[model samples]
Target: MLALEELAAKYIQKTERVLTLLKSVNVSVSPDEKKVYAVVDEAKRYLEDAKYYYEKKKFETSLVSVAYCEGLLDSLRMLGYVEFTW
Candidate 1:
């Protein structure tokens, strides 16, 4: 339980940092701009959900949500849709 809590905290912090970095980034203007923004919006939503779950003491669910958010952000970066460092 302690380890889970610690891990969740770490991931939550990391996700928050990534979200902050994302805000300063501009998505390239291209045909996929709409789709890219949609994915970014979804990632933000997941981060919010993670925080909500964390506050509710649902560590596992919170971790999962944050992981999904991170994955989406990574995908965007990897695909060159947005530029940011993890």
Candidate 2:
């Protein structure tokens, strides 16, 4: 397993790419897709919290938060709520 320092370094290196990937994803939902939109909104909040933990040097928490964000994104993708190249 990677140590905290290595994990943090990797996170720093990959965060921008992940953020870009997230931003580049196109999410289109109609007014009736309120629940789906809410899930996306919660994922966005987790991403923000990940950034916060990363900035504070809470590497493990940041990793978990980012993982949660990604999990949410994956769920949306599987459910056809979002579209992306990756």
Candidate 3:
């Protein structure tokens, strides 16, 4: 098992990478499409949660939050709801 500090550091790096991906992606949400907007918004929230948990030394929760963010982003990409450069 990894030490708590090591695990937390790894999670912080992951969260940073996910945030970078989000920054790199170009996602446009239509003002009229509430459903798609909600989905993207939820993903953004998860990203924020990941950072928050990572700062608090909750590596497991941070990893889970980043995973959820990635899932939402992938679904949006698959549905053609958002456009981004991979």
lDDT for every model? 0.83, 0.68, 0.69
* Tens-place lDDT digits, model 2, residues 1-86: 99875675565446445546654334454344777668778877887787788788888988888777778777777767665443
In model 1, what is the error at residue 73, expressed in angstroms? Answer: 0.5
Per-residue lDDT value at 2 in model 2: 97
The C-alpha stretches of model 1 lying farther than 4 A from their native spots are 23-29
Per-residue CA lDDT of model 1 for 11-85, tens digit only, reads: 888888877777533555446677888998999999999889989989999999999999999987877777777
Q: Where does model 3 exceed 4 Å of error? A: 1-32
Q: How does candidate 1 score on lDDT? A: 0.83
Q: After superposition, how far is residue 34 of candidate 1 from its true place, in Å?
A: 1.4
Each candidate: RMSD to true structure?
2.2, 3.5, 4.3
Candidate 2 clash figure, as a count: 0
* Model 1 TM-score, all chains together: 0.85
With a 3 Å backbone cut-off (N, CA, C), the pairs that clash in candidate 3 are none
Tens digits of per-residue lDDT for model 3, 1-86:
99765765665566456545554233355445777778778887887887788788787887788778778877877766665544
Backbone collisions counted per model: 0, 0, 0
